[model samples]
Target chain A: MSGGYPKGRIRREDLISAAAVVYGEAGYHGGSLREIAKRAGISHAGLLYHFPTKEALLAAVLERRDAEDADREQLGVPPGLEVLRRFLTLAEHNARHPGIVDLYSRLAAEAVTPGHPAHEYFERHYRDARHRVRDSLRVLADTGELRPGVDPDEAALAFIALMDGLQVQWLTTPSEVDLAGALRGFLQTLLTVPLQP
Target chain B: MSGGYPKGRIRREDLISAAAVVYGEAGYHGGSLREIAKRAGISHAGLLYHFPTKEALLAAVLERRDAEDADREQLGVPPGLEVLRRFLTLAEHNARHPGIVDLYSRLAAEAVTPGHPAHEYFERHYRDARHRVRDSLRVLADTGELRPGVDPDEAALAFIALMDGLQVQWLTTPSEVDLAGALRGFLQTLLTVPLQP
Candidate 1:
């Protein structure tokens, strides 16, 4: 799958990667297709071949990021603590991908509109991610990993909120803060459950 | 100061407020002076009379929002717990003002440029805000409201990160999540040392 593109043929994944970099640096509105193409070393037509429009390209960039994140984390139906670990790992990875962070921030602001394309994506993404976290907490509860009578749903929501909130701070002040470390410390404290060594 | 505009004169504050709303809804590029004037029930000349340029208008909008936030929270130098309470209150207030949130998001995205007007605003905003938070934590530590030997700076950074990360999530999924409740819960857990209730 990696080697299928010819020497000059812009691979879909490569195009998306380039788009992410451009979007991250300049924002969706600030970035231009021509610039993304220039960065990718391809013509505008060539870039548009993979992504028909800027909107499509933005959606593709976000979708590819989500898929890559899932793959990188190998995120699965793990127990709560394990899920928390995966979530933190993903946040750490996002620290390196400022583009994805910016894209998420931009889309989030835009999502306030009733029918933005990314609106449904963000909505479903949160819903599913929250459910996964909740299920993990349930497993931890069953195994006595969490304190008795802890509300998994609330805990999961708080955990997700923490992750989401930190990214915004990181974007504005990347030089002064270690967002991943902060989150890890907070999560470690929350996960009173003993880890399987 | 409240009557600074005089009767029937559109105050500078009113123009700034209208600019914030226009920029928040239509984005900086998409928003125009004419539209802002229309929103303010004034002519374009009237809008420009207060703000010499679009950049000036943007700066005023951002500054005005910050002032309003500071006034509403009555945020001042305080202990860590008090700082946390003020931060949470301000965040809740911000959540209610989706327009300001949107404007901040847009400006943050634009701030990637080293010399963008909002760039300095954000850089100093975070630096000063973090310093204030750290100072508050130091006070808390001195009063034994923090766990012994805990790093106040790290705690401050973590709390700020949590707020920023949570705001992103809240904006992304406002319909389904109670951002204030989630933040309160997270902060409660993060504070290991019990204060005198």
Candidate 2:
């Protein structure tokens, strides 16, 4: 019932958050467990106590990120445009967490391997996210907020594509691309509802 | 100037092409000069005869891929929907060579480092591609192909973002996501131009 934990134990979630920062900054191949431990202000032994292996640590980092994102978005039904607005906001906010973004990119590339540990996570993430977006558009369609004849599935795919694509650009050249603005404009033009007034 | 190599020595261009394939398959970190030489059907010394070091070989691989892509796309002139069409073709064709896609994804992630070899290539790539797309949209605008008051730059950015984003999906779940179809639909809808209806 309570989220509280023992005072002495380095909380697993805190260790994962710190690891995410390190992994994001240094990349999966470049990051070191010692550095993550240092960042969390804990001994390496303490860090290992929470995550027995580097892979476990990385997995925890990704899960923690997803949980945090879910928490921020409230993970419930909402208006179509509102859902998009919240998604864009979360994406922009994610930009500040360079570690998580970098980790996401690295894991994405690795996911190409059929047996990669993160492959299922990414696959399920995209599938579920696409369905969520499609459902939102369906709601909009039902409410007459969306123009008739629009394919909700295609629209959902486009939205997902834009998010993934912009993240690459943002990672490549963060200064030049305005992730949120571009998404807002693109969605406004694509969808019936205006993303911005 | 002789286009053909004289004698048994492998041409530098040939060596670079082979290296691209090897690196594309194994990744910059996972790949090695030995593997590249093996793939090229040459001795280690012969491989070094072209690219002196592993880093140099990696750089050559990325450079060759860029040059090949540019040459294929014909870097200078503005292409209209043809550009998107060509991109889709290339992406679909690339499905046969998963190595290239894997290499690109890997390099893109590592390209975050300012001094990384692929950094400049991707930066100029995005900028140049953006300009080309924008120019194409300008042509569309002048011919009244786009809806009135549509911003070409924003449209171009969105198009590129869509391509980048969908590629992630294509790479992740090629079976489920029809990348080219999704892209063509999104572009047609965004530009309000009928695609050979």
Best by DockQ: 2
Over 4 Å off in model 1, which ranges?
A1-14, A30-49, A147-150, A193-197, B1-11, B29-35, B41-46, B147-150, B191-197
Candidate 1, pairs of clashing residues: A24-A99, A164-B165, A165-B164, A165-B165, A165-B166, A166-B165
CA lDDT of every candidate: 0.72, 0.74
Best by the lDDT measure? 2
List of clashing residue pairs for candidate 2: A24-A99, A165-B165
Write model 2 residue lDDT over A64-180, tens digit each, in one string.
778888888776646466777788788778777765677787667656666766778889989988988888888878877777667888888888888877877777888888877
Candidate 2 lDDT over B41-139, as tens digits, reads: 778897787788877877777777877777875544456766666666666666666677777776776676567767788888788777877887787
lDDT of 1 by residue, B92-115 (tens): 887787666667766665564566
Docking model 1 quality class: acceptable
- Provide the TM-score of chain A alone for each candidate, in the order shown: 0.82, 0.82
